[model samples]
Target: MPKNSIKQDENINNISNKDLLIRLFSYLKPYKLRVFLILILLIYVMLCGLLNPYLMKIAIDKYISSKNLQGLILLAIAMFILNFLSMIASKTSIQMLSKVTNKILLKIRQQLYEHIQKLSFSFFDNRPVGKILARVIGDVNSLQELFSTSLTSFIPEILTLICVTFIMFYMNFVLALMAIIVIPFLSITLFSIETISRKRWQNYRRKRSNLNAYTHEDFSGIKIIQGFSEEEKTSRSFLVLTKDMMDSFVKAVRLNDSFWPIVTLSSGVGTILVFFYGISLLKSNRITIGTMVAFIAYISMFWRPIINISNFYNTLITNFAAGERIFEILDIKPDITTIKNDIMPKITGTVEFKDLTFSYNNDATILNKLNFKIYPGETVALVGPTGSGKTTIVNLISRFYDPTKGSVLIDNINIKYVNLESLRSQMGIMLQDTFLFSSTIMENIRYGKLDATDEEVIAASKSANAHAFIMNLENSYNTEVNERGSRLSVGQRQLISFARALLANPRILILDEATSNIDTHTEKLVQSGIQKLLTGRTSFVIAHRLSTIRNADRIMVIDKGNIAESGTHKELMKLKGLYYDLFMSQYKFLD
Candidate 1:
């Protein structure tokens, strides 16, 4: 298993249920009027339902037993009208609730997506993309039932329970007491079951997240699995994750399924007790037959609400686990955030690292007490062995990561105090692995400057030597590039990336092995275009090919996180230092 897989299994601390619920329901505040109207409609529906049983009691005592046909027909018609109105109210309330719930869901999903975008890159570094997707798409979806049913079903049931209890006592206190005798025992059982089920639900959600993460990773790397002939092994591993998720779901459902039986048994016991006691009351002439029948009807009505409430509790417990998972991400404080009064000045592109020391997770230093300055419009080439902090230096200048100690400055301004958007917007970076979105060639190039005109986009492409190939495509600049530009060759992708960078017209440009993947012939073709793009911009180039940096104004050989040599290429060749050794190693064949 990969190291990230192990990290995924680590336990997540859940917030208290009370706090989670408070925060979750806050999303409903915006639709208060709609919720209020739904509540009123639901109350009316419950009242209409309650009236039917009383009408039945009246028919039995005043009309059926007495054989009064006129009275019976009148009561039957009334019952029908009441039932019809109840149906209308129920339907209307549900429709309204659905609209409100869906709108709230849209807002929640939007907020989550925007928050994820603002989060620092470090957050993404440790989490799987699939796991994040599960939170935004799956976890948010789990709350749909809660939203739709809470106002229409759950709240109405609570009101029903209260109303039934009061009406039962008013009719006959002794019979009402008998009907509710088993409630305390039922409540205890439910509370105990809920305690056990909450943990099981948490486990189920965690396992589901893991399964999603695994599936996403496997599909993303399907090409590698085929290349290595490890399809069977990968399939077995996925099965293990799937099986774990299934087991957890089954265990949670088993506990949830127990709830209905307990409620049913309790209701049965209450009804039996009420029946025998009511018969005794009637026999002793303490209550009329009509009252006895009404008591029985109330007993049935009473337990129905209890059953609905119990089911709502079950739904709450399950979705509470999902809610906890979602809020955890929302609670994370981004490592990088802009100050309220941050500056957005136009950059002159003079970058300086002042007494900088940095580490990842405070493990080992990658750059130590580094100090360097590049004047505006100077092109500096960096050559270093792998892991010698070549990329780290450029990353610092771009403000991707803050130094553990000291500061990085741009145009005599501390980057930490500058608006992140303003700082990054003025800089263009093209890495060895060029990433192009699944979009048309023109749109992908225009991504650097969203408002760039079509003519400007075409001009930029021509400057990067990409216009000729783009014109040959079936749709010219309109041709679609598949995900990450997989449809284009390596050289074509790099040139498009260059076009994108050139279109940005940034003051600072960093190229990290931008031509590393291109063939020799392709590199020769792009070399002039690259020089033209870097002519008036401050540039940092990390190149392994010594020939590419021969004309660089200055070349710095970085070793062990420090500059081992710095001078023009010809000046460094006479020094016989690290730069000389690296150059000789690459072009020794020519000698």
Candidate 2:
């Protein structure tokens, strides 16, 4: 049973006909000449198939029963020549078609990869990386069957059936008519089953996509699961999802399996009927034995094309689902895009948010109609309770997400009027959750400025107080951070992120809870380093530890998406407002 399931899974990965044809046509658009050549070879192969049975009938009628050795010799040589040519044609057709199909798959995967990179951030946020990868690689690869087999074979199969039928009718009208009676019945039944199967197949695809997403999320977060000792719980959860996936697959198979057997049985019954009726005609001398023999051969050859045509229905379903998934992604318009003819001007770090209002969804606002400005060379600290829009404000500043209303200006120009890359190039950000690539420490720091030299990387690391700890390591600047910086301590990761930001040399710097992870001593070290970096630059710092931002040129105390207080820390302290109350609350704990 386990072996059987493994085989079933292998078949399920194949693309259905709809997706296959759509993909093949699109990919083959560039290789139309090759595709046409493949089709021509297939037509030649099908013509050979049509001639084979006719050759047998001629030999049997003119030589075998006539006791003529010379005639038999010529017939045998003719048969051998036709067989040899058929073999060559078949081999050439298969090889050419297989190579073309594989090339199409390569093109499809490349296009999918390129298109996905251009998709907006919101699309990735809503979809899983594993599912996207599966669509690009797994789903696209599955379509090989349609191109290599179905597409190349389809025209030949139909042509062979037609040619064989016409020859059989010319020989004996009654026998040919009797044999073809099952065609319409088989076709109608296959069509109905295929329609139902396609819907089930689509559902199966969705479930599989969901399964991939869950498995990816689970494996990526394995460390967190182990840290919380939730392995058993996670396994149980995964088991439920796998079970549903299996059930969906089983249902699709059941529908697909039913059609194949019905087709096989229908062909068997038709052949039996043809044999009985043809023999009666032969015994009555209505048709010659040679004619009866040729008709039987045609009957046997006939059902293969029918079966192939029927099976293409299932293949079409798989392809349709795959095509829909691919098109769905390609159709999405990026939420943020650069405007036509917009050019960013040189900036001097001044920033202003005028009546900014935003909501992640349409429901409730996260940032209300509010206005604030930071002059050149000023440090503005944003302090707020959880869910008070501190990070949202910074996100808008970086153009990660745009405001639903109002304007954000940098150097007196609305951000929307500038080229996205140019506007963002003048700014640097370090989020609370730092992301490090699985590369060297030097590369991580150089990520901020792709052209930074080794010396510059070291300088940036020193400015962020990350150079000492990095140098203490065995590999120092060449140390691999591993995936998501898993090999580094939280404090070390934060330091590296700060170093990356420093390398950018931005006129506008954003520190979103940058010092939240370091120890008290390390925090003090980072604080001193930050003061040096922040000098002569406009900076926005979001700090949970209010003491870190006490010397800010201005402090904005935010509450529920509105700026409730704005002033120097000393002046805000005199008001004894929300900021004072929150700071004093934390101060008592410190005391």
Report the lDDT tens digits of candidate 1 across residue range 1-591: 112452266356677878987998899999999889899999989998778777878888889899999999999998888889888988998899899999988988898899988887677877888888888999999999987767766889889989989989988888889889999999999999989999999999888889888888888788899999999998898899889999999999999999999999999999998888888888899988887877777888899889888988898899998888888788877777655548759888788989999877676899889888998889999998999899989988887788899999888888888888888899998977799999999999999899999999999998888998999999999999988888899889988998898899989999999888777887887888889978888999999988998999899888888888899999999998889889898889656
* Global CA lDDT computed for model 1: 0.87
The TM-score measured for candidate 2 stands at 0.90
Candidate 2 runs further than 4 Å off: 1-24, 66-82, 128-130
Q: TM-scores of the models, in the given order? A: 0.96, 0.90
State which candidate has the highest lDDT.
Answer: 1
Question: Relative to the true structure, how large is the alpha-carbon lDDT of every model?
Answer: 0.87, 0.82
Lowest lDDT sum, 10 consecutive residues, model 1, at: 1-10
For 1-591, candidate 2 gives per-residue lDDT tens digits of 011111122123435555646645777788788778878877877777777787888889988888888988988888788778878877887888888888888887887888787665566765667677768876787778766656555677777778777877888787777778777887787778878877777777777776777778888989899999999998887787788778888998898888888888888888888888888987889988888888888887888787776676567665666666666566667677766637777678889999999987565899899799889999999999999999889988888877899989888888876788887888889998899999999999999999999999999998888999999998999999899999999999999999999999988999999999888988888888899889999999999999899989999999999999999999999999999999999999999
Candidate 1's displacement at residue 340, Å, is 4.4
